[model samples]
Target: MGHGTRDKILIAAATMLGEDPTAKLSVRAVAARAGVSTGSLRHFFPTQRELIDTVVAGMYTVDLPDDPMQDTASPPAERLVACLQLLLAQVGTGESARGYWRALHAAYVASPPSDDAVHAFLAHERLAVHYVERWLVRLRDEGALAPGEPGHHARFLLTVVNGLLTERALPGDLTRLEFEARTLMTAASAVLRPASSDRP
Candidate 1:
């Protein structure tokens, strides 16, 4: 089928899956939702696995900043904070995005060991790490950070962020953004602090 038709089918499938994680995704259901014919859906995704795979892949695809740490005009710390905020914004509690995330997590947990899940998890983790690395690199280049391994600091930051994401996913009183922001600031300070009081 044409690109438009295929895209429509994917959208329909994603919407349905978001609504009900346990919903059986079939060609007929997706086609009906998309207002397209079964033949068209088949032309795009010949099998259920293919369609599901595509949706899974799309979930991790995010719009990353071209230069997440550099705005040249802004302070490096400000730029870094903005970049981090952008990442956090993706974890929406809204119905559509939240439902999609919930469904994705359920599928990941239920599926058997597979390369697809492994690859997706690695890719997302790398992206988070790379974002942190960029911020560290920029800060170091600008002489804002103390001497250290930027990559190591980046990995550490990513670990912290991942933990925060996990905590946010669970049912509880959501941590206020102000608290999160302050916590991040404190962590960043600790990561960049100078070694000794006597050091000039």
Candidate 2:
């Protein structure tokens, strides 16, 4: 089978899992979704376990930010908030976020995808924390952050972000969501900033 054929199956499976943690991704279902034969899918992924594992690994693969990661020369607070917003953006928000949700719902309601009942959705949380940690490294390099564990700072930032995403899962005023997000980012920056103005 063509390598592209194999990749298509994996991509189809991964997209299904991201949209619905409970998605049914049988070999036949995935093959149909990928526009390939069951034989082809089996050729790439010998068993359901292999297929599900590949999809779980891909659960965190997404375009988290439109902007380049290296562009962190802006003010520490601004950069910090931007990083958080990137994560929230992935979680969805307001009108733009709704489009993604609608599509995900539509995909779930109409699909050719599931395997094991296991959902590796938490990989998204881990990915978000890593993204935040990268921002912290940028700050530390610029002498803007106080010495401490980057993971600690990352967890704190992700906590607020995860809460924001959780709240967003339900119906709410967009303005309220934006306000709460801002408040969280501000508090996170304050806690992470150095006490003195001196660089080092």
Candidate 3:
């Protein structure tokens, strides 16, 4: 296949993944979606494993804005609430969020991911942590953080979010999920001292 054909396949695969993170990116499926032949898809990706690994690596690049804290005039609590929303938004939203987590849980139950999958998963996680740390660093720079390492505090808040996602992945219960998410975010914000309380 030509490079143009290969680009079509990759674009189609990325679109499918963005819509559904656990999309089965089989060559045949992606080829059909891309309106290309399986042979053409294989010409570019070479193998299903290669295709998946490449897609995961591409998807793992989640970056934060240089200035994630958009409103310097807002109260520290309000700024933190915005940060928490940004962090949770990374998990995704609506049916996409539910489907993403559901697929991940199913994969865990059916079979473990391969070594490449493990590496890609770790890369995704590290990127997420870095994104969160950026927000925490912003808060610290604004003198809105409690006296402690931003990395440590960011990890603690992320741990709480993960715990909520794990313990409360109730099927067809988006309302409860939203409530619990807000409650957890509130708890996360509570860890931060008021702006006035920052160390001189």
Candidate 4:
């Protein structure tokens, strides 16, 4: 019964994240969603950071839908660009992007984050980098990309993504999507260099 209740809480939290990327996974919110008492939630996850980390860690094994990396027919750069687009699509633009940043600030930036909160944030960031590295490794092994440290390459791509996320929240030109696509294409091309097909 203890294990079942814990699972119930995790499922409820995950569902909330899925429904809204900006949903604040507060203890009370999760408990209410799980149809469990706050005490029950606290029993399994003593802190909001623990609950968030557990739900995100659980998601590590779940494959993303329509992963473009699996599409071998496309050039490596195009495939990677598509994958990055999938990430960007989640945050969206304008109000949706603003909402996400606001939630993020309220959770981790409004005040000094607890150590556990910092750890959770770093873990999530590393997981994102790991996913990108995996795709880079596959491309390298298949001779679609130049051989190099995939981790470094992944971090570079993620940095570009970080910049784009900031841009998404601010007022932008009508060609935002086009600008994003071009930027990603450039980044992807740079990372896949020495490959004839990857040339800009």
lDDT of each: 0.66, 0.68, 0.68, 0.85
lDDT by residue (24-92, candidate 1, tens digit) is 567788889999999988888887767777875675453465655657787555666666666666665
Higher-ranked by TM-score: 1 or 4: 4
- Which residue pairs overlap in candidate 1's backbone? none
* Candidate 2 residue lDDT tens string, 1-200: 49799889988987776565445578888899899999988888898777876765664454454544456556677667776776676656666555555554654445532323323233434655666777788778877776688888888777777567656766787587668767875756664665366756
Encode model 4's per-residue lDDT on 84-180: one tens digit a residue. Answer: 9888888888998888788788868899877766766777787888888888988888876755799999999999998998899999986987999
Q: Candidate 4, clashing residue pairs?
A: none
Candidate 2 vs candidate 4, lDDT winner = 4
- Residue 164's lDDT within candidate 2 is 71
**What TM-score fits each model?**
0.56, 0.68, 0.64, 0.85
Off by over 4 Å in 2: 17-26, 47-49, 52-65, 94-119
Candidate 4 TM-score versus the reference: 0.85
- Model 1 segments beyond 4 Å from truth? 1-68, 72-75, 94-101, 172-175, 193-200
Best-to-worst lDDT order: 4, 3, 2, 1
Report the Cα lDDT for residue 83, model 3. Answer: 69
